[model samples]
Target: MCAKKMTYRDALKEAISEAMRNDSRVFLMGEDVARYGGTYAVTKGLAKEFGEDRIRDTPLSESAFTGAGIGAALGGMRPIVEIMTVNFSLLALDQIINNAATIRHMSGGQFRIPLVIRMATGSGKQLAAQHSHSLEVMYAHVPGLKVICPATVEDARGMLQAALDDPNPVIMFEHVSLYNMSDEIEDNTKVDLKSAKIRRSGEDITLITFGGSLHKTLQAAEELAAQNIDCEVLDLRSLRPLDHDAILASIRKTHRAVVIEEGWRSFGVAAEIMALVMEKAFYELDAPIARACGVEVPIPYAKHLEDASVPQVPDIVAKVQEVLNSDV
Candidate 1:
């Protein structure tokens, strides 16, 4: 609603800018985000408005700067730390998985790290193994950290505000390929940080997903509908504290589910979702749940192979049909 034609990228940027305007304590820091306006230009002009002091740019040391941002959050300021990619987030894993994740619990629940770390994830630019990875499940596995994946324009707009307002540390994962996507936004475009949104409603089957793969699921839902198979789409925006109620409700209605995730098939978020559904919605399910996930391999550099590695529209459509057609 802030921009004439809203993009997922702009929504996130505007949310941060609005937060900065409303709260002096909200600041930003990352590599090239200040001067270069970020690798994807998410903060193209923020440095000029907030000035370099607040919109700080740090050295390429992901570990040092990300840790510094965490320290800054502990001291006072609400810092939004931008890691260039999920691939690079591994460099700061110690800081994020250890200190930032454990501080609140280690300090007898006295300290709250109100830090927001944003990073681009998933493979779409033919960036090989080192440049592309979806490790959101790893972050979500931590007890004290909150993980969010905003798969829509409105969520991309609103989640940052909710994340900033939270007293605990939050990591937001944005897929690189989704930055250019444009979507409709209403004036009442805000959303809660902790709940899931049912993007499309149906009773035949549930297409469960978040982040980059959510759009693929939605497209599959439409394709399935053409064949008279109605699919329910659940966007698990908050990956960590998944809104199980939304998922179970849909599965309870559809009596079936097909999870879609862009990450590798092994130990992925999709696997977790399927497990949760089986445990909580077992009696409600009329058929076995399924998942359409990335092939179990390092993403290849070739265009076709890269495309083959991740979940695609065709794969989701096929999986939904298979789930719907399967016997319990």
Candidate 2:
């Protein structure tokens, strides 16, 4: 069982390349995906390898290209649409929500969109409010879309293939900060599009998070470990169709839980997870479930202000401690 060391960006590129090589039906279309080799350079050398037809580039219009992707998918092609960022995805909300997400149901199963939309999400690198956003929750709220946030190199390398195999549309959120994260992935890695993974196991408080917040939560767990406070870190890999059984299993063991997310506090993914714990695992709790989330404001352009707006290691550690110290 040899492991290959690579950055998260490289892992993603491998996934796309493998899919295109294996399936003639699979192709990628988006702004600068081919010529510019992706905004983050995840698709750097793909165009040269796969050629322009398979790695086609589109105009700057998110709605137009996204709709074109939907049309291609409907025509029995597996189209991978790469939006520049989550903030820009708002322009394609109509095509995503109204069309791609509802075609199967609206047509009574006559049409299925085997479309995969990838977008960079989260606030980092001083991108400001317009370019930085944690909008996965918006797509997860829809019924027909499968939303996934892969927080590890393994998941990043494997989830794209799973998404392409599905009969419905899938949206992948690649955190803007994770592109350069380097780690070893198992040589024979297999990733599912569903299921939450417990990155670290502990009997004390459970730390639940996904996407960019995952490393911060795991780091918080490590810091808490040194202070004699054990923390279980749960990565909610699949946002839609959340693995409730896995979540409740961890909650049952840990008793106290703290959900974390980079999205705003109000009606965010953390809120949904906390509410689920209350509903299904209420009697298993030793204290009230808590959450740490982003401040409800447009992300700032300044470095310090931007960092303060999102959850960090210290923020997660404090939240875990607060939940652990509860007298309830």
Candidate 3:
């Protein structure tokens, strides 16, 4: 496999093109996916290569197009549906929850929805409340669906193929801020979706996060290292079926845990992860688990306010410090 530095956007495009080339059953459907080349340009020029039939574009009807994607998947095709953003995905919630997620159980295991839904998520770019939000938790709450957040360039290139191969529906959340982020990745690397990955190894404390919050958590780890606090960073790649083994193992080693998320703390993904740690690894903890999360308010349009609403690098560092300082 060839290794080269590339932006997250290019990596996603390569993943989609590769998937389509390898599987004749794979096709993409969404608003502006073809002529407009996708909202983030991840599918740009794919239409020229795959043609309109495979790279079909629809009007501004998320529910209709998403339902069509579900239908296509049920009809023996692997369909990749793109909802413009997480905010817009609400329009297609019925199709996703009622149909795509429940088809197997409802049909008594007679049908499977091998569909992959990709959407831009997280708060950044000053897009205001409507366009910016981290709602991956809502999707993860569902029992039958699989949710994955590709926090790195390697994952951005590999997770799509893995998602397509799954028998159940998979929701892929791509942080908008990461589209321009660049990293070195092998051309043909395949990422497994079953487990969380430890981004850094340490013995003092464990920092757990995913999606846009991962980089910030890693930054916090770096700063903590300078302060003589060795921190381990775990990227929770798959949210629905969380890597419980990896989480417990890391917490067992470090004994101190800090969970971070771009979503609000109450009932957020962080809360769920914290619960898991508490349930399974409570005896191993040296202190109470800490959490850094988004503010419980509508995301503001102003740049500074937007930055304040979500978890930042400084917030993560401060939380980790607080956890370390707390006495059992």
Candidate 4:
């Protein structure tokens, strides 16, 4: 297979471009997405290539534009709605959870919302508390939506197409920290929106995570390798319909697990995974399942404080070692 190296931003742009080229129904609408080339520049040059009608720039109102996207999808258009950041997405919560997510079920299958909402999420750029937290758990908690966090270049490039093919709504989270991440991906790379991928295989412990935290977890695994602790890194690509089979399989093999998340510890995604393990794979555990999550507070603005608030490489390594050395 032919491979090419590109930044995560470029991969996402390629996905959007391919989708638009293949389907006339596909169009993108969001703030600064057209003329300003997007806040992150992912949509740069796309406006010119696709024309203003296809690549649209909207008002500052998230709710207004998001509702417009939903209407477009219901009217047989594959509308991609870009909420500049996860924080701004809150304004569109009613439109998203109420309209886009529920119209299909409310209409008793008569209506299907083929909406794709893309948002830049997570911290690392020092954008401060308002612009920074990982709010994926809120979206994942909803039953009618498909929530996905693409952690790799292949997924960043391929998941958009998969989402567009689905009959319902899909929410795609692109971690702000990963925009510059570059890697070699196959030209034929295919991505499924439902599977969890095992990036690194091991038998000692499973370091379960997704999105931005994936790289940090991988680095932690590397550091742990020197101490003879083999860590398996499982990327929970799809947060909504989590691949329980893959998660359980990893835990059953390792017998010890440490779930990692950038969200706050209380009632976070890690907690849900931990509960699942306890119920289905309780006997497989050699030690209590552990979690390394962000501190329960607004994300700080200062670089050092922000770094301290979330789970870092050292934190993950220490948590893994703690689980390994536990007598319980």
TM-score of every candidate: 0.97, 0.98, 0.98, 0.99
- lDDT string for model 1 (58-96, tens) is 998999998998999899889999999998999999999
Most lDDT-accurate candidate: 4
Cα lDDT of model 2 by residue, 174-292, tens digit: 99999999999886588898899999999988899999999989999999999999889999999998999999999999899999999999999988998898899999999999999
Task: Please give the TM-score that candidate 1 achieves against the real structure.
Answer: 0.97
Q: Compared with the true structure, what per-residue lDDT tens digits does model 4 show for residues 1-328? A: 8999999999999989999999999999999999999999999999999999999999899999999999998899999999999999999999999998899999999999999999999999999999999999999999899999999999998887789888899999999999999999999578999999999999899999999999999999999999998999999999998999999999999999999999999999999999999999999999999999999989999999999999999999999999999946
TM-score of 4: 0.99
Positional deviation of residue 314's Cα in model 4 after best superposition, in angstroms: 0.4
Candidate 1's C-alpha runs over 4 A off are: 1-4
Best by TM-score: 4
Once fitted onto the true fold, the runs of candidate 4 whose alpha carbons sit more than 4 angstroms away are none
Steric collisions counted per model:
0, 0, 0, 0
Q: Where is the poorest 10-residue window by lDDT in model 3?
A: 186-195
Return whichever of 3 and 4 wins on lDDT: 4
TM-score, cand. 3: 0.98
lDDT on C-alpha atoms for all candidate structures: 0.88, 0.92, 0.93, 0.95
